[model samples]
Target: MKKPHLIVPEGMEFIRDDIGYAPAVLAGNTLYISGQIGRDDQRQLVVDKEAQFVMVFENMKRVLEAAGGSFENLVEMTSFHTDMRDLPLFMQVRDRYLQGVYVAWTAIGAASLCGAPGYFLEVKGIAQLN
Candidate 1:
């Protein structure tokens, strides 16, 4: 069996050293991405709903790129939302990144996420790497 490779983007070492988890793990042709919350490059939580939504997707994009793929490679995605009402705006920002490459998706309503209340969304995905 091939050994799994941990995929951590540049400047994301905190996710491993502080959080104790790989941002994503690549096994053979499959890439398993961890749930990324709405945080800026400085790790500060974003306050705006739409910006937060975009930030989380950017985080996922970074993980995918580190694994030598893009959003187009995503085969499955799961998202958690603190407020279900944000679905419409979330879908709009999501579509901007996905660009119509359809993937299996599940949106879950969560009471809270990332051990906090301010985070509005968290997204995790699986990609098939070429």
Candidate 2:
């Protein structure tokens, strides 16, 4: 059995202290990333919808990198959005970060997220590490 390894990327300390959850956890070849929101390093949520969408991916990228993975390594992704109307904006931002890698993804509409008021979306993913 492989032991679970917590991924604590630099500049992501706020997630640990404020949320009490690891940004990501590596078990064997798989990395399970926690739901990432649009909050900055200071734990402040971004106000703009488009900007917030981008920030979610950016936060996930940091965790993936820390786990020795990249966007191309992602095998599945699930996103939670406060409004389904923002799907277009979220897709645009996702394309920018994911490039052409086509991974299994699902987007769900949610009423809100924990600790992030005014945030429009959150994303979590599973990645295969090399």
User: What TM-score would you give candidate 2 relative to the actual structure?
Assistant: 0.93
Q: lDDT by residue for model 2 over 8-37, one digit each (tens)? A: 889986545665698888999999999998
TM-scores for all candidates?
0.95, 0.93
Query: How many clashing residue pairs appear in each of the predictions shown?
Result: 0, 0
Candidate 1 lDDT score relative to the true structure: 0.91
Report every candidate's CA lDDT: 0.91, 0.88
Top candidate when judged by TM-score against the true structure: 1
Best by lDDT: 1
Quote the positional error of residue 110 for candidate 2 in Å: 0.5
- State residue 52's C-alpha deviation in candidate 1, in Å: 0.6
lDDT tens string, model 1, 2-116? Answer: 9998998986777656666888999999999999888877889999888899989999999999889999999999999999999999999999999979999999999999887
